[model samples]
Target: TTLLRQIAGFDFPDSGRITIGGESVERVPVEKRRIGMVFQNYALFPNMSVADNVAFGLSVRGEAKAVIATEVQRALDLVQLGKLGGRRPHQLSGGQRQRVALARAIVTKPRVLLLDEPLGALDKALRVDMQIELKRIQREIGITTIFVTHDQEEALTMSDRIGILRDGRLVQEGPPEEIYNRPKSEFAATFLGDANIFRGDSTGDGIRLADGTAIAAGVGAKLAAGAKASCAVRPERIRIARDAGTPDGNANMLKGQVSKRIFAGSNSTYFVERAGQTLKVIVQNTGMERLAEGQDVVLRWSPESTVLIAAN
Candidate 1:
C-alpha cells in the first residue's frame, strides 16, 4: 500500500530537490512538470502507425497539425525509424516498438524523463543493446532522467546517481562506483553483488578477523578494542590460486578448500569453505590450473580493498 499510494505531501530527507531549470517544483502540477515517463512495455496503440503514435502526445495537447507533423518526424528520426513511419506497432519488432515509445515520450520536450524498467521486456542480447541505446539517447537529449530498474548493470551503466529502493524505503543512493565499492551497510554490500562477509574482532589498535588474522585496514580503528565487527571483500578481488602464499599489499588472506565450482560464461565462481562457513570467489579464465573442487586454495585480497565495516 505504501508503494501504491501517492500521498499529497511527502518529502524524503535527502533525495536532492525536485527542480526543473533552477525552479523549485514542490507544488507543481504532475502534467505541468513536463516530465515524460516510459514504462516497461512499449504501450503503443495497435491500430496506430509509428507516426501517429509518436505524434499522440502533441495531438492530445491540442497542438497545430503542422507542429505535430514536424515534431513527429523529428522524433522518428531521433530513433532512426523515420522510414518506418507508416508501420503500426503490430508490424514492428519488440525493440523497434520500444524505440517508437521512447520517441513519443521525448517528443513532448520534457525537462525530466522517468523510465520504469524500460528494458525489462527485451531478451538478454536485445536488453544489453537497448541499454546502450537508452543511455545514448539520454545523453543526446540531455534530460535529467530518473530510471527504475532491478538490473544492477543497467543502473550502474546508465544512471548518473542511482537510488536503491527496498521495502518502500530508499536504502542507498549514490554514483555506481560509490554504491558498489563503498556500501554503508551490510545489506547494501550483499544486495549490490556477491560479498565475502566475515566476522571481525577489534584489536586494541586495529581490527582483525575472528581467527586472529589482522587486516591492514585502519578505518575500523574508530571502534573500541574487543568490539564485534563485520568486514567484506568482493569476490573478484580475491585471488583463488596464488602459489599458496601472500602476494603483496593484500594483508587479508585466508586458506580455504574449494567446495563448489560453477562456470558462468567468461568467469568461473568457486565456493570456498573456511571457519565452518562458505565464501565465494570469482576467477576470470586465468590460465592457472583449473581449480578443482575440494582443492585447498588461498583467498587473497588487498588490505585496502577489504571494506572494514562496523558490526550491524
Candidate 2:
C-alpha cells in the first residue's frame, strides 16, 4: 500500500528523492510515469493462451483490434516466444511462461521497466538463458530499468549499475566492475563475494599474524601498522605454490597448511589453516596440473590483487 502510494508520486522525507529521466517524480501519475513491471511466479492468467496474454495490456488500453494483434505479435517476437502463442501457460515450460509475462510488460514500450525476481522460478540452464535474453532486451529497448533481486549474482550479471540495499537503506551503488573489484566497505566486500578478512598487526615494514608468522600484504605498513586494520583478498587471487623456499618479499606471502580441499569438476577450493584461522584459495581446472589434497603450500598474492580493507 505504501509503495503504490509512493510510486504514484508521493514523497517521504526520510526515504530521499526519486527521479525519472531527469525529472523529479514527486507529482507524476502512474500512467504518466511510463513504467512497466514484471513480477515473479509468472503472474499470467492460467486460462489465457499466450496470444491473449500478450494482447491483454493493449486491450485494457482500448487499442484497436488490428493494432493489438500487431503489437502482440511484435512483443512475442521480441521475446522469441511467437511460435508458442497458441499454447496456454500450463502447456508452456517455466522459461516460456516467464517470457510471456515479459512480453506483456514490454509491449507498451514504457520509459522504464522494473523486474522483480524475473528468473527465480526457472532452473539453472533456463535461468542462464533468460539472463542473456533479459540483457539483450534491455539493450535493444534502451529503457532505464531497475531490477530487484536478493541474489547478488543476478544483480551483478544484469544491471548497468548496481544499487545495493540493506536494511531498507541503500548502502552502495556503482558499476559492476567497481562493485566487484573495489568495494567501498567491508560489508559490501563480504556480501558480494568471497573475502578473507584478516587483521594486520605490524610495527614498521613487518606485518605479523596472531601466531607471529610475518608476511607482506602489499601494503606500505604505514596506515595499518600499530593500529589494527583489515585485509581483504579474493579466493582466486591466492596462488598455491609448492616451493620449499620462502618468498623473496614479506608483503604478500603467507604459510598455511592445507586443511581441506574439494574438487568440483571445473574448479577446486582449498582451505588452509594458519594461526587458528582458515584462509581460502580457488584453483582452476587444468587437468594436467591438479593440486594435491594435502600439501604445505605457500599462499602467494600480488600487491595489486590484495585489497587493504579499512577497520570499521
Candidate 3:
C-alpha cells in the first residue's frame, strides 16, 4: 500500500522518480493525479448507496448534479449493476460489492486505474467470474490499468504484460507466456508455476543432474562444461508412459517410479521418483486409466521444453 500510495500522491517517494501519462507526477496532489484506486478490501462506504459511491469522486470535485448522475449511471451499467444503484454495501453480494467498488473508481474517468487484489475477497467461483467481468469492463473503458495481486493465476489471466517483483525490485517483466515459458531465473520459473528443477553441472550440451543423468535442453548459448547450471521443465510439458516406446530422438527421457498421485478434477499430478529426485508431471483427466503409485513410468519431453539458467 505504501508503494501505491506514493504513486497516488498520498506519500512522497524518497528517491528515484514517479511519472504518469508522460509527465512527472511526483509533485502532483492525490486529487489531481487522475489515478483511480480500488483497494483490496473494495473500500466501499457502507453508509452510502451505490449511486452515491460511484459519484463520490466527481461530487468531491464539485461536478454538477446532472453530470454526476449521468456518469454514475454509466459506470454502474458498465459493471452490470445498473439496477442496484440504491443498494448499500452491506446489502450487496461479495461480487456485487466488488463491482460497486470498481464502478466508483472508474466513474470519474481517470487516466490510470490501480487495483489492489480487486477480487481477493470473493469466493473461488465468484473470483473467477469477476476475473472475466473485470477484464470485460476494462476493455470497454479502455483505461490503462495496473493490477497488483499475489495470485499467480490472476496475474496470468488478466495481464497484457507482467512484472515480477522480488524484495521491492523487479526481477522480470514480459508477456505472461514468455515469462512462464522462458523464466530467466529459478525464482521466476517456480514462482510463476510448478517447475521441476534439474540442478548440477552444465555439460555444454545440456544439464547433468546430481545423479549423473544428462538431460538435453535447448539453450541460446551453450554453457561451459563443468559449469554450475540448472534447468527447469513445467509439469504439464512432460509425457509419462509405461515405456519409452521409440520416443522422439530430440526428446529427453527419464525413468522413474510414481511416488504419489494427486487427483484434481480436471487433471492428475504424479510425483515420480528417479535417482533421489522427484519429478512432477501433470496430465489431463480423460477418464482413462492412470498409472498407480509405485508404478514404473517413462517421462519424455522435447529439449525445447526445458529452460536453462544459472544455478544461483
| lDDT winner between candidates 1 and 2 | 1
- TM-score of each predicted structure versus truth: 0.88, 0.86, 0.96
C-alpha positional error of residue 125 in candidate 1 after TM-score superposition, expressed in Å: 0.4
**How far off is model 2, as Cα RMSD?**
3.4
Q: lDDT tens string, model 3, 1-312?
A: 667788878899889898887899999989999999999898888889989989899999999999999999999999999999998899999899889999999998899899988888889999999999989999999999989999999999999999999899899999999999999889999999999988889888788977778888885336798999899999999999988888488999999999999999999999999988899999999975789899999999989998888767
Q: How close is candidate 2 to the true structure, as a TM-score?
A: 0.86
Model 1, range 137-184, lDDT digits (tens) per residue?
Answer: 889998877777778777788878877777777888888888888776
Error of 1 at 112 (Å): 0.7
lDDT of 2 by residue, 31-144 (tens): 667667787886899888899998887888889999998999999999999888899999988888888998998887787777878888888888989999999988887877
Candidate 3 achieves a global lDDT of 0.90
| Per-candidate local distance difference test | 0.77, 0.76, 0.90
lDDT of 1: 0.77
Model 2 misplaced stretches (Cα beyond 4 Å):
1-15, 201-227, 244-246, 287-294
Candidate 2 local lDDT, residue 190: 83
What would the TM-score be for candidate 1 when compared with the true structure?
0.88
* Pairs in steric clash, model 1: 250-302
Instruction: Arrange candidates, best TM-score first.
Output: 3, 1, 2
Superposed by TM-score, candidate 1 places the C-alpha of residue 242 at a distance from the truth, in angstroms, of: 6.8
lDDT score of residue 146 within candidate 1: 72
